[model samples]
Target chain A: MTQEVEMKEAQAPPSNSFSSASTPSTLQHLKEIASLIETGAYAKEVRRIVRAVRLTIMLRRKLKAATALAFINFALVQGSEAHAKLSAYLPKEDEHDMDVDTASSASQGFAKHALPEIEIYCYLLVLIFLIDQKRYDEAKACSSASIARLKNINRRTVDVLASRLYFYYSYSHELTNSLDEIRGNLLALHRMATLRRDELGQETLLNLLLRNYLHYNLYDQAEKLRSKAPRFEAHSNQQFCRYLFYLGKIRTIQLEYTDAKESLLQAARKAPVAARGFRIQCNKWAVIVRLLLGEIPERTVFMQKGMQKALTPYFELTNAVRIGDLELFKTVAEKFSSTFSSDRTNNLIVRLRHNVIRTGLRNISISYSRISLSDVAKKLRLDSSNPVADAESIVAKAIRDGAIDATIDHASRWMLSKETGDIYSTNEPQIAFHSRIAFCLNMHNEAVKALRFPPNSHKEKESAEKRRERQQQEQELAKHIAEDDDDDF
Target chain B: MDPRLVEVTQIFGRFKASLLRNDFVTSSNLLSQLKVLLTKFPSLPPSFQRTANAYEELQIAREIYEHAVLLSVKTEDQDAFERDFFQLKPFYADLKGLIPLSPQEYPILGLNLLRLLVQNRIAEFHTELELLSSDALENPCIKHAVELEQSFMEGAYNRVLSARQTVPHETYVYFMDLLAKTVRDEIAGCSEKAYDYLSIADAKTVLMFSSDQDLSNYVTEEHPEWEIKNGCVFFQKAKDSQPCKEIPSLHLINQTLSYARELERIV
Candidate 1:
C-alpha cells in the first residue's frame, strides 16, 4: 500500500527537488558518501572526503548552483562537522549585504551571477541542519529570516518553499509552547492553501493544525477541524501515515477504541522502515486501544525488532494483566509510570486496574469452592486489616461483571460456586456473549461510518462544468472539420 | 521605560489583586491577556544585551501562571488547572539557569504531580518527576507525592490514607481528598465480599466515615442490596429474594450406585 502511495507521489507534480541543475553523478556520489559514513568507513578519511567534495564544487562552478544540495547530503553524513562548515559559509542575518551575490563572492565561487533560488535552498538546508542539531532557537531565527526574504522577493514559484519554511517556524514555536504564535502561523497557512486550492498543502497544514490542537488538549477545536478540514487524497507514505496516526489519536481520545485500533494498525503497517520512531508510537497507541477493548496483546508485539527496548514497560504491564496479579500490575505501573504518562496512555492504564482485580477474582474463584469474604480480600490484597466489607464489595462487583461464577452466602459469610451442571445452565453466560457480540457489531458500524468518504461536491461540480465545456469545444471542431471537407469537395 | 513593560506591570498587578480576592474569572482573563503579550515578545529579546531582563520577565509570567493554576484548583476546575499547569510547565522545564525560581515553585510543581497521580496519569506524573532537579525531588512537597504514589502502588492502603494528613501544601488537600476516596472505595469493594453483616458503628469505622448519616447514605447509594435494619448492615437481602441453584445430590448417588453395580458384574 505504501509503495502504491509512493508511486502516485512520484507521478504527481513535485513539491520540492534538489535543484534543476542536479546531475545523476553528483547524486550517486552523495549516496556513496552517505553509505560510507553509515558503515563508519568515512571516519578515518572524513577530512579527505570533505576536501575532495569542496574541490569538485570549486572546479565545476556550475555545481555551485546546487551547493545547498551537496551541503544537505554532507550534513546527513558528516553530522556536526557539516554544521561547522555550513556555519562558516552562511551569511550573517544582520549583514546589510546578506544576499546571494554577496555570499557567492565571499565564498569565492567562480559563478559571477548568484541565483536567488539557490540562496533560498541554502537557507532551507541550514534551517534543517539547525533543527536537526536541536538548536531550535537558531532554527527559528533562520526560518523567520528565510521567510522574510521570500516575502520580499514575492515570487509565485517559491510559495511551496515558503509554506514549508513556515511549518518549521511554527513547529519551533510549538516546541517552545508559544501557543498563540503557532496557532497564528497555522491559520495563515490554512488561508494560503485554501486560496491556491492546494490540496496537498492543505492536508499537510491540517495535520499540523490537528497536532497543535491535541498538544494543547483542545479536543473540541480538533473535533471541529476534523469535521471541516479539506479531505485530500494522501499520495505519500509519510502523509498517509500522519493522516492515519492523527485520526487514530483523535478517535482514541473520544473513546472510540475499535476505530482507533484499526487506524493505528494501518499507520504502523504503512510507516516507512526509516520512520521506525513513528511506527513505534503508532504501535504503542494500538496496544493501549486493544487493551481497552478487553483484548490481550500478543507477546510478540513487545518483541518486534528495534521496538524491544521502547516497549519493555508495556510488556511488563501486559504480563501483570495476564497473570491476574493486581499488586504486580500496580508495581509495574509505578516502575514505568513515566513511560505510560509520556505516551499519553496513563488514563487507559488506570482503567486496567479494575481488569486486573477482576482477573484476580476469577483465578481465586476457580481455585476455591467456598472461601470467606475476608480471606478472599487478604489473598487479593484489598486491605491490610479488617477487609471484610471491602472484600464483599470486590466479590460482588466481580460476580456482577461475570468474572467469577459464585454466590454470596450472607448468613454463612461465604461465597459458594455453583455445582458444575448448574453453572452451565445459567443465563449469565448467554448475556455475556450477547453483550460481546453487540459491542463488536457496534464497533464495526462506527468504523464503517468513520471510513465513509465525504461527498466531493466541489470536485463533482468542477468535473460537470469541464464536461460541458469539452462538449461545446468538440461541436465547434466538428463544424470546422465539415467546412474544410466542403472546401476540399 | 518600554511601554510594554508598563503594560506588563499593570496586568500583573491586576492579576495579583484578582487572585487575592479569589476572583478566578477575572484572573484567568488577565492570564490569557498576559500570555498573548508574552507570545508577542521576541523570545531572545534583541534589545536586551543580555538575556537577564527577558528571563526575569519570563519568570514573572511563570509565577502568574502558577497562581492561575492554584486558582483553578480553588475553583475546582480541573481542566483549567491542567491547562494552566501545562502552560507553566514549559517555563519551568526550559528556563533552567536563566533565573532563580521562587520558593513556591517546588510546592506548586509537587501539587501538580499529585493531581496527575489522582487522575491516574502515571506516565505524565513520571515525566514531570524526571524534569525536576535532584534537590527539588528531595523537597518535602515533592517527596510527599512520591511517597504516596509508592504506597498506593504497593497496596499499602493504610499508608496512602495516612499520607493525607501530612499533605505539604493547602492545595494538596484537594487531590488528597480524591486519593482518600479512591482508597476507601477499594476497601469498600473488598469489605462487601468479606462479611455478611457489620454493626452500623463497625461499618462507619471500617469505611472511615466520620458520621452515621454518611455511612448510611453511602450504603444506600452504593450498595442498595445491603439491608440496613436492626442497627446492622446486612450485605445480602433476605434468602427468598436471593437466587438459588439446587444441588443434584440424587444424580451423584445414582452414578455411584451404577459404578458399584458395574464392579460387581465384572467380578
Candidate 2:
C-alpha cells in the first residue's frame, strides 16, 4: 500500500518529476507496478470494511475509496500503456475527474479512478444516464466520444457501447424533439439490429423508430418496418405488445380499419389485463373508430367495458362524457382537471366538457337549466386563451352543420416543430381530435408559442416561424371562444 | 248421397272412359270413392314388407321421392303425371292386377328446394364478399371461394359461348312443347281455359309445327305482315288498328330473363 501510494504521488506531478522514473530497471519496475495493483486490490478489501458504518455515513464517501482502489488495480493492469498515451492527451487524473463531473453531473464524484475501458464505459453510462436525466447536450458529447472509441474495438465491449449509443441517441433526439435525426439514428440502429439479428435489440430500435415515423406521418416506411417486425416470444410480451400497439396505429393510418381493429385488439390481448393503462388507450381508440364508423351499439359496449378497466385518468373522463354519463364525466373530469394543473390530458377533458356544455346550450330544447355551464367552464379554466376554445367552436359548428368537411388550416402554424411535425395533425377536424384538444388545454402557453411561426414565408425557416405565430394566435382565439365568450359559437 | 258428389262422379267417369271402353257408369260411384282414396294415400305404402310382392312395386314411388331429395333420379318424374299421381293415387291403384305404373311427381318442388340450396351456396359466396369488404380477403376460406367463383363464372361463360354454335335440336323441340304446356297450365291458373286461347295462339302455332326455321323466318311465318330489322320483328296491323307483332324467337330467347321476370310478376 505504501509503495502504491508512493508511485501515485510520484506520478501526480509529471513536470516536476521528469527524471524520477530512471530510478529502477525495466524488469524491477514492472514487478513494482504489479505489486502496487495487488496492494490496490487489498485496499478495496479495506474500504469494504468501512461500508458498514452507520446511516449517518454517506455511501458516496466509502464508494469513492473503493473506486480509488479499483482504479489503482486498473492502472496497474491495463492503464499503464493506455495512461502513457492518455497522459500526453489528457490532464492529470484528479483535474480530469473534476472537469467531467462538473460539466456532466456534479454527483459523478471521483470519476478519475475509472480505467480507460471503465472510463469509456463511464462515458457511455453517463450518456445514457444524462439522457434519462434529460441532459441531452451532455449525453450527446459523451455518446459521440464513446462511439468513436467503440469503432476502435472489436470485442463485446463495443457491442455494449453501441447498444448504449442507440439508447442515448434515441433519448437525446427525443428530448431535443429532433425527430428527423432521431429517425436517422433509429434507422441506423435498425440496421445494426439486422446485422446482430438480436430480437430484443431490433424490437427496441424499431419501436423508437416507428414512434418517430408515426409522429411524422411517415406511415408507409413505418408499415414496411412493421412487416419485418419479429414476433414476440412469451418472455418479451411487453415489447411485443408495444410493437403491435404501434403497428395498429400504422394500420389505421393506412386506412385498413378492420386490420387496424384486429391488430389493436391483439395488442390489447397480449398486454396484461392489469396493465389498464395500455388497455384503456387501446380500447378508447378502438371505440372511437367504431363510433365514427356509425357502430354506435358497439361503441357503447366497448366504452362500458373500458370504464371498468384501468384507463388513463384523462381517457376515463372524456369517455365518460362521450357516453353521456354526465354525472360520472363531471366527477372524473373535475377531479382530473384539478389534480393535473397543466397536464395535456387534463386540458383535453376540460375542452371536451366545455364543448358538451356548449352543445347542450345550443340544443336548449333539452333544457340544461339544471347545470351551471359557467361554473363548470371556470373550473376547467376554459377562460385561458388557448386551443380548447378554438377547437370547441370548430367542433360545435361542425356538429351543428352535421359534418366537418373543413380542413384545419391553422394546423400549419402549430405543427412546425423542428423535430416532429404536428403530433396533433389527425386530432383537428378528425376522429381523434382530443389529442390536439388536450395539447392545447395543457400548455396553452407552449401551444401559443409554437403557433408564433409566420404563415406566409417561402423559405422553410421563415415559414416555420410564421406558422408558429399563427398557431399561437389560433390557440389564444380558441381559448377566448371556449371561456369568456359564450356567445361566440 | 250429395248432388255435388254425383255430378263430380259423372264428370270423372266421362274422363276415365276415354282411356278404355265406355263401361264407366256401373262403377262410377266406386271409382269416385277410389279417387278419394288415391287423394288420401298419395305416397307409397309405409311398409313394403307388410304387403304382397305385387305391392313391393307399389312402393317404388316412395323410393323415387327420397331419391328426388338426393337429386339422383331425373328422367322419370313429370310435372303433370306427378299431379295426377297425387290427385288420383288410390283410383289408379285399384286395378292391382295391371302393371304397376310409375308415379309422376311435380319435380318443381324438388328443383325449388335445390334452388334454395343454391341460394345458400350464394349466401356463402356473399359471406366471402363480406370478408373481402372487411379486409379479411387474405383468409384461406375467402381465397378459396374467390378462386372457385372466378373459375365457375369463367367456365360458365365459355360453355355458354361454345354451346351457341351447336343447336340442341332434340332438347329444343322438347323444351318448346314443355313450354307450351307450362304456358297453358299457367294461363289456366290465371283464368278459364277459354280466356287463355287468345294469348297462347301464337305460341301454340310454333309448338304444333315440325318445320325448322331461323328466328327471322319463324317470326315471318308466324306473323306474315311482320318485318325483321335490327334483330327485331315488327308487324303492321290493319288500317284502323295499332300495330302489333310477335317478337322473334331469337330475340325472345335473348330476352328470356326479361320474359321470366315478367312471368314471375304475372304468376
Candidate 3:
C-alpha cells in the first residue's frame, strides 16, 4: 500500500501518463469524474453521481483504446473482474501496461475506493468502444455481462448508467437481429426496474420493449405491454421522445391517424435539435398520418432544416396524393417502395390510395358542373375494364365521406356538383375561428408548463441553490446518448 | 410425471378425443375440469411456481390449452376460441424457450389472423401480425393470411374471392369462406352504387355467385330495395327530396361572437 502511494505520487504530474498518452485534459477530466463519483458515494448524493455519468458522455467520444484502458486501470482495483473484462474488449498493445496498474483505487483514503458506479461506468465506456470498433459480437457479449452486473445493483446512482446499459444491451442485440432472444430478458429487466422504482431504467426498458415488439410488427403485444407498464413522469426527455415516437407508430398501424399525428408531431417538437434523424423520422410519420387524415401538411414541414433530402420522397408522395392522380400516385409508390418499406410506412401508403382517389374526385367535382362517370373515370385514369362503374362507386364513396359537395346522379350516370358555398357566410369560418382559439389556448398552456414552479418551495436566500439544481438537471439532459440513434452507422 | 400432471394429461386426452368426435358438451366439461385441476400445479405462467415436475406440468397445461383452442374452433365458439388462444399464447410467446416448438402454433396463429380479418378487426389483425418472427411469417398458413390481407387492402376483391379455394389448412377453410362472403358483400355494396342497373348474369359475376339461385336469394332476402325486372337488377337509390341541410350558421356565429367578447374581457 505504501508502495502504491509512492507510485501515485510519482505519476501525479501533468505529463507522465501511461505510454501513448492521451491529451492531458482527457486524463484530468477522467480524474475529476473519479473524484466526483467518490464524493457522491461518500455524501450519498446520487445527483452528483448522475452528473458524473453525464460527464462521462464527453469522455466516451474521445475514449481511445489507451485512454479507456488507462482510465479503467486507474478507477478499478488492481485485480478486479470488471477491470480485466473491460480492458479485454479493447485492443491491447505488444508491451504490457502493467506499470499503469499500480494506481490502486483505494489508497491512503486520498483517491477513493472502487464504487459500483465507476465499475458500471467503465463497462459503459468499454461497451461504447467495442460498438464503435464495429465489434458487435464483442459489444453484445460485453453489454450482456454489464447488464447482468447491473441487475445485482439497485442504487439510484447506478440507475443512469444502468439505463444506458439497458439501451446498449437492446441495441447490440438489435444490431445482430437476435432481439427476440432478449425479449424475456428485457421484460424481466423492466419488471426489476419497476419494482425498484428506477424510473429512468423503466423508461428506457419500456422503449426498448416497444422497439423490440415493433421490430417484429407485434403491435397488439406492444400496445398491451405499453398500456400495462407503470406510468410516471418521464425521467429523461430522450426516452420520452422515443416513447412518443413508438406510440405514434402503433397508433398509425391501428388507423388512429389523429392520435398518431399528435404524438408524432409532439415527438418531433420535443426532440433535441441535434437529433436530426429522429426528428426526420417523426416528421415522416407525421406527414403520412396527416395525409391519411386528409389534411395536407404545410410545405414548411418538408422544407425543415437538414431534413430535405431525407424527406424528398415523402414530399413527392404528398405531391402525388395532392394531385389526386391515380397514375402519378402509383408511379410514386412504385418508385419509393423500398424507402417506404424500410421506414415501415409502406402499409400506411397503401391506405393512401383511397385518399388519392377522394382528392382527385374532389378536384374533378370542383372543376365540372356535370360530368359522365366514364369521362370522370377517364380523367382519373381508372385503368379498369369498367371505368364508368369504378368512377361511379368512387365518387359515391367520396361524396359520402364529405370529400366533395356533389350528388351521384345514377339515373343519368353523372355526378352533379353543387356550387361552392361562401366560406365566410357558412359555419366553416366559425369552426376555423374556434380551432385557432384552441391553438392559442394550447400554446398558452404550454408556456405556463415551461414557466410554472411548485408553490412555496422557493427560498429566497437559496435561490442560487435551486438554480444550481435546475442547471444540473439540464446538464443531465445536455449530453444524452440518444443522439447516437441519429448517427449514421 | 407428478400425479397431478398425470390427471391433467388423462383429462386432456379425453377432451381431445371428444373434441375430435364432435362432442363439444362433454369435452367442454372436461376442459373446465382440467383447468380447475391444473391450477393446483403451481408451475403455470405468471408465477411459474417451481416444483419437482414443473416443466412437465407446464408442458401438459400448454397442451391442454392448445386442445381447448382447437375445441373452440371445432365448436365454432368465437368467444371461447379467443379466450383459449390467449391462454395458449403465453406458451408460444413467453415460454417458448422453456418448451419445444409446437406444430400447431403457426396454424393457430394464422387462423386467429383469418378470424380477425373476417371480423373486420383490421387493427387487431395488424397488431397480432406484428408479433410474428420472420420464420413464422414464412409458414404457409401465415403467408396465406398475410397475402389475403394484402389483397383485401389493395381492393383486389377478385383475388380475395379466389383465395377461398386455396386455404392452406382445414381450419383456415372456415375463415376463408367467411372472408369470401365478406369480399362479395363489399363488392355488392360498391357495385350497387357504381351501376344504376346490372343484368342478372352480370350481377352474378360481380358478386362471385356460382348460381343464379344464390344471387336471387341475396337480392331478395338481403337487398329488398333491389328490383329485378326485365332480367336486370335495378338498385333503387333514395332520391334527394330534402335540400342539403345548411350548416347552422346563425348559431355558430353567435358562439363565435361570444368567444370573441370573452377574449376581449380577458384581455
Who wins the TM-score comparison? 3
Model 2's TM-score against the true structure: 0.30
lDDT of 3 by residue, B5-120 (tens): 77777888888788889898999999999989977888787777777787788788888888888887777888998999988888888777777888888899999999999999
lDDT of 1 by residue, A117-186 (tens): 3345446556654554456777777766665565454433344444456666766665556655557667
Off by over 4 Å in 3: A1-21, A90-109, A376-391, A453-489, B1-74, B84-110, B131-267
Candidate 3 is scored at a TM of: 0.76
Task: Give the Cα lDDT of each candidate.
Answer: 0.64, 0.40, 0.78
Angstrom error at residue A389, model 1: 7.9
All candidates: TM-score of chain A: 0.61, 0.40, 0.87
Give residue A156's error in model 1 in angstroms.
Answer: 9.2
DockQ for candidate 2, C-alpha atoms? 0.00
List the candidates' TM-scores in order: 0.55, 0.30, 0.76
Can you tell me which runs of candidate 1 are displaced by over 4 Å? A1-146, A149-191, A194-197, A206-237, A246-262, A272-277, A292-294, A300-317, A325-358, A372-489, B1-98, B109-160, B174-202, B210-226, B234-267
Write one digit per residue (lDDT tens) for candidate 2, span A1-489. Answer: 012123223333432333323322222232232333333334543221111111101111112211332333333233454333322222235523533333234223323443333444434333533443345676665555555565454433234334535555655665566667556556765776666655555666777777677555456567777787665553245556667778776655444557767778787777664455566566655543343332332334444453544335535554564454445667776676543333212322332443343333333313332223233234333333443332323222332333322211121211111122344442233324435544544574465556756465555655777779657756754554322211100
Q: How does candidate 3 score on lDDT?
A: 0.78
CAPRI classification of candidate 1: incorrect
lDDT minimum window of 10 residues, candidate 2 chain A: A50-59
Worst 10 residues of 3 chain B by lDDT: B236-245
